[model samples]
Target: MQFLPVVQRIVADRWPWPRSFPRSLSMVRSLVLGVMSLFGSVAVAADWPGFRGTGDSVATGQYPTKWTATEGIAWTVNLPGYGQSAPVIWGGTVYVTAVDGAQREKGFVLALDAKTGKEQWRHALEPTQKAKWSETVSRAAPTPCADADGVYCFFEGGNLLALTHAGKVRWERSLVRDYGEFQGGHGVGSSPAQTADTLFILIDDRGPSYLLAVEKQTGKTRWKTDREARGGWSSPVVATRNGKPEIIASSAGTIIGYAADSGKPLWKLDNVVGNTIPSASVSGDRILFGGGTSRSKDAPPMGAKGNGCLRLIDADGKPGYESVWSAKLGISNYATPLAYQQVAYFVNQVGIVTAHDLQSGQELFAERIDGPCWASMIGAGDYVYFFGKDGTTSVLKAGKEFEQIASNPLWAAKSKPKSAGNESRPGAGSEYGAGETVYGVAAADGAFFVRTGTRLFRIGQ
Candidate 1:
């Protein structure tokens, strides 16, 4: 008779039927506990997680601004192979990718002690067929994405892999096989983004380009949408508009927004230049996008043919969207535009930096700073660091006008030109005038991690 009251309470609580009641209840409880554990892990510390630091595209940690090879260097470990991907710092580990000499593709999600740069564990993915079209210096440029659960790395050959924090393989998927061919001359280079339970990637190649969402825990496809435009190399960023998160992506000729859960296209802005390589940066509700001409010949007239423009897309609209204003002056060829406070800065490969008013698409200041920039700009407390191809690093003030702080040189001692096929053939002749040849830069823990030709340097004060 005493048990009757408990049974009644269970019935009133709408518990499942007795046919499988107890077993099902225990399963449900297990799931709930698992989810809680995952949440607890993610809350431990603030990790980089993805390509552009957090989803906001701002690298805001206690990073240092001024340093030399010996000044602020924390620890520099020689990477086993070579990679052009930026190092993704998570919790206490730094994950990066690399390739072997035989072109037998290998990926490494390295866990480095956050403080001392000590090797924690190196998780290697199954070897893949190397991409022939990819430049030797630009092999597998896709950066790793990590959270509390695991770190995800994408290869140029279309392999998506997941590794646990302790160097265990979680799950892996081949994009080229499951999805389709990525048709770019350089192969797939865009990094994947992670939300609550989804891993989103922009697979824009020559074939049918698409934005794919996979279950973060199991590597299962959640939803994949074939993008309307052709594929480019820019990664996608999650934006919050009207209290809702939207995955904002720029492809060949359009910038689009899709629901984070479902793969539905929420809104799109056409007439955008195709082959865009810069990721979208969000400042409040306005999304800033700019790029150069798709065709190589059109490079001469960048903004003239409408190939480059700074577009401000209003993310508050219902099923549609409108551009607040667009200007031709703020277009970037390869580097993504950086927005700090109210000013958005744009820099092209040819070394032109333009400052624009975020509210109004007005060009506040435009000046030619340096030439041939391939690396993305990183803004620390008060300085914007620009690494040029000629091995020169220029430090400038982040303001309306150009203010050069310091110009440092990165000269390699070797002068032999090494062939791509044979590492011993020779070095690249001279490094004094080779520009910076920098690919990516990240700021964290008060030190700047700069990825040069074959080394990762910790530069800062």
Candidate 2:
């Protein structure tokens, strides 16, 4: 029955979602625009493949807005335990995930070498339900989904594997051994939503929530649904409308859509409020979604008309979706609200970066960067990266006015890098004891990986 306070980072901005799910921008103009840049250009390797990359976290090349902590980095790697998950690439390899015991009962996946981060294979996993490691629980927090047929990962104790880009496993599932025990204490941060053979997965916990799909070549299940216990941690996107594919799902009070091929439902929009931790973003046919500040002041309005935009309307012919614009201020708390190109960024949680106008939500420019962003802001070519949790990243200018351009930093408070100790629990780690923060961000070939819960860096140029 706990509807808030899951990880409670001091409170303030409470919502900001954008699990985008916008697929083909023609694969970002055929593998990232004028191809790579930051110092020597011509590297060309694009493939971020999941949790926001390509689904509209936007990436079209030209990374590195000025580095620090060792000059534009290029390779860092250290992880073996802590993970807030997010580091997936495909085509030169680079998958990630972690969670060591203290009761997390181990889980890993690794597989680096995207041009020399090395490692190459790890696998591990085995947590049918151990749950005890903390920092408010959710260690390996969901963010895997590669393609060219492989990498799936999902841990939060329920496990869900799938390896194979040479790491070899190809199938594994546990969801607490076939669905049960996930009653919320903030475990599962939901992340897995493919299409090219299904894979969805949502699970809003409190007990009994659901939204599966599976079958990406034998993991088998294909359809589930259930939902309505609602605790919220958002993640499940994949849009398309009018030509088929669906599955959006903005948590908490509701924003459903399902039917990515038989999971059915279709459309819904109910009450909604402070949107359970950011997760809904797409651009072209719009979609966007936002929410924050709701510890229940009777809970209903989340400001600026509850931050909005949704459009997938066919009406008389059935298939629907329509809110069509609302942000005159924008709201979001755990990062995840960026539309790019047509502009629409919101940052809230103490860094206030609003910029709306992705087709008429007006309010262009709120300003205040240098922090706040639990990883969810990356729009390549012509910049738009915010990354800061405690490592600074800023660089904005996707245009509509709020130009920041560069803030960079990533390590240098005495070199940062400490949270990796668990050796049978002696002192464990994390709770912010040195992991420094910066939870996740990714970019392809030309580099910019940045994930910290014990390091992952890459940056570039």
Candidate 3:
């Protein structure tokens, strides 16, 4: 389809028509042009449109299982600046975001040719709010989501904008300017979630925390629901419950569902202790919530929180949800709880993966992989890929049993790029200095786009 315009132009101007061209043939040409215009670049099934893509559930189509630093690599491209956001794919273009300078003064949105990893266009995003950049703080961590209309990006510095496929800015909004300055120690990591017409953003900070729904086309606030001041970085998930869609947020010890259209509170599940970082995952009528032990000393044990499936029930003329099954063995710390193939998988911060039966919540096996994973595990077909924080990925067979497949490292060694050295350093043995960490990833069109802090890699057959 790269030459689609050329084909259209030729048909319009240079069609080999005789002086007495048949009117029937002219009608045929007009119909062909109309069909092309009708299909004009909508998001197909192959597009990974948003965060954890459709609740981080199992992905269709086979992705690459094994790859080395030098082999099976389609192309590796250096980004303009360091970014923690995952690379999102929409057709032939891959969109990613990054922040530049010591104070994160400038942000970058880049569109790359998906096949060759060539730079298609780069748009420098000027931040509305300024903050001193540091390794401990988030740097473009909120993964941008894509749709057929455009790619929408949100930065921790309070800038959100929509860009077309050809690098045209549709609209931009400053959340801090519209709302207020964020007062969280660490910056925002919650990515944007969207339905057909609205985009949902979770802003959970110590100062002003709220759930906002924006009109996708105009970047205007549709509805805003303010909440108690709580510091959390969990992203919101849009799920259909009781035949209508609801925006679900499991953070700061509560799992609350809000009506997507009206921003009215639907139902709330309390006592989800230490549930801050990982977003909720959806599986049919069941929603899987995960939490780890918080750094606060008084926080309850991780198991005390919502670490299981909840069945949305509509009984006695009331709509509510109840926990169907709870995890007893391990709880998710950074990664969201994964439920695939009737098996539930939980990964702790130290890279230990625990499997449980999706129905009974019985622990199947507990095994360690090459982890300390920050990026969530993506299940493709019969294999689940665990992206480690420090450039290694462990692939495992997806089933009730723990079966190791392959350990793929994105880089042979931890090499610091010039861009990474500019950031201020934290204390020794801190997680801050790991420049090669895999922040997030996206899989689509038979390729896996792995996002490290400073680069993006495409892995394919």
Candidate 4:
């Protein structure tokens, strides 16, 4: 009976309890020392802070490399509206964007429990102007960036708002009123990035474009620099070389870097064209970017069309920068390539997955999946998770050879999709959305979050 009470005290001491709760001295120390063993598998080493995880989109925690709709799914929740912006995870919370209502003007920012997929807070944003959303340009297409204090979201029609973790609005800004109309065939997809105290935003479109850095708390402009980039949906990334800040972006036929502190031009690589959709991924000093038209209709060769490159950035504030390698081997139009295992894996619009050597730019191997991919790939360690437009998630080994581990379908089993077609083969149509579409994906908090038209799924143990 004495040992029984002591055991009970130990169990109670394992977690926080009221003052009246008893604790055994040895038991508390034992439980405290075993913290990592108790929760290591369920913990995320770092936050998925922005459009891409920590700006570059590479993950360190163990995420699910394979899962199906009715198989390894942890939880699923319906969203207010449809979007293509990937989810961002911070601590125990996951944040995503959407637009509600018939007019589709109701922009919303949602906070959910990262582990349970439970709804935490839903903050709806008021748009400055009525949004005109299309299949190509989604209303809530730009993924939000989050920090320790707040989450910042930008919607189509240039509506921007920052919300605290508890769903309180901190500040709001209008990109449309501040910068003018977003004139283009498609709308904005430039998500926000952050330095220590400044938030960096790049708006590159047919209308006036600029890169603006704003103070985090008040949303006041720190620096505003004009940009010549027209019609790009890629998000900006923040990195540092030799303790200085560099905000890098790939858009409008160039890979440009800006001084994060003063919003001044640091360097640029011109002659890069057709890379507009997916945000560039980074690995240490190198940035990998790729995108282009997958379907040109009846029109044939418009010169040699290929949009992909691996460019190394000079982090030391040096003026010179060079491409580590350039090739048409692994160029993705919408889906962003994931850099893993020292190779950049690019998935073209029609499901052509290519892995190119990061150091040499030589084509390693290519494979065809069951569908086209709209969302960018996210990697954790040796495994990469690829989301297809038809709600399929293909798990692959991040190796030189093409090795597919699993082909997991996302939609309900009742929904049937045709076998993936070959883009190079004749009589094949590579149109997108073959079934229920999966638009965005993220990996954090020991789980993978997938975004469908109107739902989000958390996949892990």
Candidate 5:
């Protein structure tokens, strides 16, 4: 272990010096304390219950700044099926959901041994309604939400269910059976947010768009608020505004915040760049919003397009929230923007990253990364982790300037580089769909978890 040498050095270097008996005893006391602390450090790491950890997107512990494919991996387990949903950690197990069959017909949930990467349990789910999604994305794109008692998973086919920590199905429901069909361009990609008593969901579709809060214990709808019937992939985030929690959902024309408990409309910031693909991140009363997609072939080049501005929105309560600052120079494309310390980060689909001041939205630095990232960035201590679509993990030093700490890949040794060789397809990048895809990442206690298309890996545990 990395700490073993440091413990030995501290206990041996200056302990048995030429000293008096009382001084020696004091040194012994310090040595005992040091060893005890070292033992405490060996305890099991923490848990990341949902997307962006606490549904707030703030990673709070010291994580490793450097690692490699073989060097720093604590464990790696192959997933049963392929899904883009990120892995959520709770209790001593990690939970993930994926779609099966060549048609992506089946959806399943898997629980893995957090320490050993062993399959503890697997539940092949029976969909309440058949799912239909575009070939561009998987059927199971929404990430799962995990808590102490159970984990809730949502599939693009309109299935939402709660299962106990031991993999027993507690409650299940189909959104399509209850609320007609999801009329969206990309099926369902929004992951639900879990609160103390409710499971909040953002259903943006062509038929009837609504935000609903479901009782966690029973599969009962608490409240449903209708929205402008439009489709988007952004996940709803629960943020406390003026000491009360509100759920914020971003779409093409509007970004609205609703009362979390009552599902009442609170505020709306309209005429955004639109075509929002990234989830909103909250910092205290300030919420960070980022770039949108034009979705038109005749549209301007993807650089901002009067759209790429990384907007720092401040909650103003009654009169509605105001855009405090907007960094248009460099902004997001697909990956969600991250606010680390006082700096806000945006990673676009083409691998470009920009860091900005949280308050002023002043550009700190603009740099290209190994990305084309779909997974949102997460920061721990002085290092921020970026998961690129090419299975590249670019570790950047968290600061005002650009400093790359290390870069690594998640592909196996025998895997060859696949080319997303066809550019004629819609939204296809030169490198898109050609190689391994890293969909999302999570961090807890001290370990970092990465979810690729077919695998889940725990590093620096």
Candidate 6:
């Protein structure tokens, strides 16, 4: 056999050394194997690094199916202030933002030991200025996004911040100063999306609203695009076209696609109507966009009063463009449409759930779900969970046909007596309500973390 330099040398050296004795390099070999196994374990239990768990809008984990205030609660902690943002879990920490009681716009990004539900750290940020037009209970509604290195938060008043896993401030920026001001009745509700290298924000403000990309490592502005504002609160999502990724966003007037790397507008569909708050969901090559009543000016005179359409954009061209079909389903303004396999599900503010065919805009089935819904529906395996504003969660099968599976109530506990001077504060009318309004629901590690008014409960086993 022709000698292959190193290979032949190694064979000759090993022939006399390993016949009846241990190799000297055996310890080194074991150490190398051990390091690889440790890396594999870390990769397996990946964190929910950002909003909607990995930007595909899929909450993946062995999340709990049935839960109540008392039952299936892994742990319950009384949050310091109030917020509507969902709890973001990363590694072993849980992070959320809230506005405290002194009329101060505070950011409470808490770190809880994911295993024991114990408090780790509470990082607070005093706002430069209090957020405007925020209802007492609805302030700080934007959720936090976390990665292995740090957690990020976006305040309603346009403050964006990054913190280390150990609770240290990494960087901060203000969207209003950097970009412009938002125009919604409520402030910014769109959560930021984090990718491997950049953090994306959908700033649909009143003046010069656009999609922005920032460097995740240093919080520096990477690229910004000033696109037409269709008046939306929907979060931007990353979708792949061909082999490249695109940032897809839906607003009141159009559904546009931008290059994720450069923030360039690729295509636009102007068939969508009304102010949009629902994020688009992608299934295979077809992207689904829905929700929003026609802006007060564009409302139809007859039939259902809202404008809803299921547009299928073909993702196989340089600038693929088309609206497969459009429908007049009156969906809720804030409820995002969810895609499950072949069918698409939508829940409106008035409590109606509609299922539509993915390919065509034909309605498959429609049914009325109890209570008004502001939180988007989440699909967990075979069941789609709908959390209503009135604190009732309705579970249904994810199918072309309608089916109500279970309805769990989170009614408030007995009202506590108010202190003597507490009644004089401004906007304290509903201080002691009878129901826990479910604003956002997130599933992770076999548990459903639900945010009511001031409490965050872990549901399911």
Local distance difference test scores for all models: 0.61, 0.72, 0.75, 0.66, 0.68, 0.62
lDDT of 3 by residue, 1-461 (tens): 00111111111100112223337766656545432332234345477777776555456788888887667777677676677877778887888899988888999999888888778888997888777866657788888878788889999899999999899999998999999998876677888887777889999888889999998889999999999898778889876643456788988888998888899988998778657777888765577888775455685654466577786677777767878888776678777778787778888877899898876778899999987667778888788888888778899999989999899877664444444332212111122224566788888888888877777788884
How far does residue 433 in candidate 6 sit from its true spot (Å)?
Answer: 6.3
Per-residue lDDT tens digits for candidate 2, residues 316-352, read 8888888877775778777778887777888877888
Candidate ordering by TM-score (highest first): 3, 5, 4, 6, 1, 2
**Tens-digit lDDT track for model 6 on 198-226?**
77888774666788898877889899998
Best by lDDT: 3
Cα lDDT of model 4 by residue, 5-33, tens digit: 11111111001221233277775554444
Query: Global lDDT for candidate 2?
Result: 0.72
Please report, as a residue range, the 10-residue window in candidate 4 with the lowest summed lDDT: 1-10
Best by TM-score: 3
Off by over 4 Å in 3: 1-45, 299-303, 415-434
As for TM-score, the candidate ahead, 5 or 6, is: 5
Give the candidate order by descending lDDT: 3, 2, 5, 4, 6, 1
Candidate 4: lDDT over CA atoms?
0.66
Please give the RMSD to the true structure for each candidate, in Å. 14.6, 20.5, 13.1, 14.8, 13.2, 15.6
Instruction: Predict model 3's lDDT versus the native.
Output: 0.75
Task: Give me candidate 6's TM-score against the actual structure.
Answer: 0.80
Which 10 consecutive positions of candidate 5 have the poorest summed lDDT?
A: 1-10
Better of 3 and 5 by TM-score: 3
| Candidate 3: Cα lDDT at 445 | 83
Residue pairs of candidate 5 with colliding backbone atoms: 351-372, 418-434, 420-434
Structural similarity to truth (TM-score) of each candidate: 0.79, 0.34, 0.86, 0.81, 0.81, 0.80
Cα lDDT tens digits, model 5, 1-461, are: 00111111111100121113335666657545533332222222377777777655556668887666656677766566677888888877888888877556788999987777678888887665554433454457888888767889988778999999899999999988998787774567788887766788888878878998998889899999988887577788766533345787776557788877788887776656643577777765457777644555665543333232223234443625756677676666677778777778887656788888776878899899876777778777778888776667898988889999788765535444254221112111111223456777877768777776666777775
How well does candidate 1 match the true structure in TM-score terms? 0.79
Candidate with the larger TM-score of 2 and 3: 3
